[model samples]
Target: MLSELQKETAKAIVNIFETGSARGDYARVTLLTGDSGHLTYGRAQTTLGSGNLHLLIKAYCATPGAAYARTLKPYLPQLADIDLRLDTDWSFRNVLKEAGGDPVMRDVQDDFFDRVYWTPALASAKRTGLGEALSAAVVYDSVVHGSWIAMRDRTTAKAGAASSAGERRWIGVYLDTRRDWLASHSNALLRKTVYRMDAFKALAASGNWSLDLPMMVRGVRIDPDALCLRPPVNASAIEVATRNLRLTDPKMSGNDVRALEEALSKEGYAINRDGIFDEGLETALKSFQRDFGLVDDGIAGPATRLMLGI
Candidate 1:
């Protein structure tokens, strides 16, 4: 089994490829034209066209203390149906973007991606007798990016099974085959993603089978610090504005809630900036809503969040 750090390094490599960040962009949303995976979102960019986006969002909505659950719950039907119209729905897209900043949403995504992609990738690696961390990373990428089975079969047919041809050699052949397939794919968008394979080829060439840290991927640095889960160093105003804060059974808690409390305190409300949205924060929020002529529901939806400037 790969050590925890090696697994993290492997994941960070793909995270950089997927979202341009080693830690992954929890709030990143991409909709590339001619892309088979429509309306990609969160860490690994689960695709709406593949119905995984629905699964990711559904998982988030079910989690308690999810800041945007109420706002996002309404769109579950459209997501489940794989409604392509959602590709252009700016409102839904904005909500998804904002939800990315929520800690609950981030946790849900880590778990969901691991369950849906990482676990299977590891199993595939073990079955092929491929124990190298880099090998696992390549398989994980194919699983997340799609068509692993077809490409794995093609590579086996061309170069023989990894068990017989040897793991490293088989992986090299697999990468070459996958690179060719991506370059010649009918989907123009997919053709552009051959860079992923190119990056892997470079890594294999360097003999970095262990996925050592301090690696550079697509111009992003994947260092020890970059792999740690933390808030973005410089968050955009829109990301901050999109967080839907509210009280929950366990009490929503995060920097977003702390920002809301600080804003309320600035406006002459007595509240603590402890990052926990408890009853005290809710009561203060209700008072602020009443004073601002908004609904006094205490749920910090867009209106309340906007009013508080959080």
Candidate 2:
């Protein structure tokens, strides 16, 4: 059984990657060809590849006992042999999103994640004698970013042996090694995402090895005791009138501009609703994107719109 702290920590960190605190399964496409010659997609991040969705579909069909499993059974075979090589095909992507993003299916997916990923981490943590909360947080984050074995390998290489060092020292070594991996990776995306390591480093630096105290991950303060399942106010309803908005389009003035201002203001960015997409708005938008782990391109394109849940 997963502890409350473990579950909450996992949810909080995943929220940073999935929707940037915008709760609800917002499906986004991330295409990659795996070593097994299969294309991976959706929110598996880099670890499970496209196999994540494939596994989810399989698990759902196998467990007809689940109240919601039967509803998704008929659609199983069609998705059973998904070839993500053609991930761009609307039929494929739509079906994938519907199944993967269904709110009812989340509990099923969570169970899958816990079984496949979190449980193993707990076992490893127990062997290392790590505190429950800290171990879960470290291992859960690693599963999303890559794999626990890789993390363990690095920890072993850096800190000599887990038996030789204290829990705090071992965690510090693991985090430092993770930072190095993220920084020197061949993939540009991996290298650029070192901020995750920085967040872990912050926890270590504060000596919060137990992770029971208040913590901050990626500029967002997390109060574990007062943690609410709901996201920040209006996170799901983040939308702006972009019918005629663009960079440096002299006519940045419109209802769209006013709408954007209101949205940004709700996010705590003070802006005059003067119907102009001025430098101020652009700066605030970039800041928001940074906080949410979105690309800081300062352009409100489809990706940005999706991140804002528009």
Best by TM-score: 1
Q: Residue 205 error for model 2, in Å?
A: 1.4
Please identify model 1 stretches exceeding 4 Å from their true place.
225-310
Residue 243 in candidate 1 has what lDDT? 34
Q: Across residues 80-164, which tens digit of lDDT does each residue of candidate 2 receive?
A: 3344444455665565566566654566666655554455556556666566466567766665445456667778877876667
**Model 1: lDDT to the true structure:** 0.78
- Looking at candidate 1, what is the lDDT of residue 176? 94
Query: Which residue pairs in model 2 clash with each other?
Result: 40-50
Q: What are the per-model numbers of colliding residue pairs? A: 0, 1
**Displacement of the residue 24 alpha carbon in candidate 2, Å:** 6.2
Q: In candidate 1, what are the lDDT values of residues 1-310, reduced to their tens digit?
A: 8998888888887787777788888998887766666678888887777666876887899999999999999998887667889999999999999999899998999888876678767876787778999999998888777777678889999999888999999999999999898888777667777888888999999999888877877777687566433322111111011334667677789877888888999999998778899999999999988887655767665335534543
